[model samples]
Target: MKKSYCPIDTFINVVKGKRKATIILHLFQGDKRYNELAKLLPDISERMLTKQLKELEEDGIIDRKAYPEVPPRVEYSLTDLGKEIHPYLKGMFRGGILFEKRIDESL
Candidate 1:
């Protein structure tokens, strides 16, 4: 992760990539194979999903395991660091809902 003057900036730096936070949130529920993640995040292009997963792995937020098989088996799970950040991310999720509700009400 990139060093920053503020802790929040450092946190943001790790999760700034496309769908990074969403991927973490999904993984927080349980370990998931690559195809399952792809299905969960249909809006993201395959290339972008691959890129984000790689970045999250590099950041030590997720663990990637591969198994030797005919088709290849790979699973992704959150690391301790990733689990540690879940509460904070969940708070952000709740905050987003609040804002979205306000926006809907305003319309």
Candidate 2:
């Protein structure tokens, strides 16, 4: 893979946007339908969600599959590369929880 000018920037580039990390974290469970993701991330606008999903897909972080039917069924799941990042994200989440607890105790 070609390296970005800055490695940290490259990481940020793929995981940029308000809900990108959350989206990835959610996909950690398993494949999810479009509506299911939307419901899970209710604060994000439809346009924003679509844009983020597209960007993640382009970055090779996630896979999007569409089924042919009366109403198209679409599902999103992490690609292999995406799954590699899951451990780091999970660690970060756990750290955040620990930090929050520390802060609460300090207060």
Highest-scoring model, TM-score? 1
TM-scores for candidates 1 onward, in order = 0.96, 0.85
What's the number of clashes in each of the models?
0, 0
- List, residue by residue over 17-70, the lDDT tens digit for candidate 1: 788999999999999999999999999999999999999999999999999998
**Global lDDT of model 1:** 0.95
Task: Kindly report the root-mean-square deviation of model 2 from the true structure over all alpha carbons.
Answer: 2.2
The regions of model 2 sitting more than 4 angstroms off are 1-5, 102-107
Q: Model 2 residue 17 lDDT?
A: 90
* Candidate lDDT values, in order: 0.95, 0.91
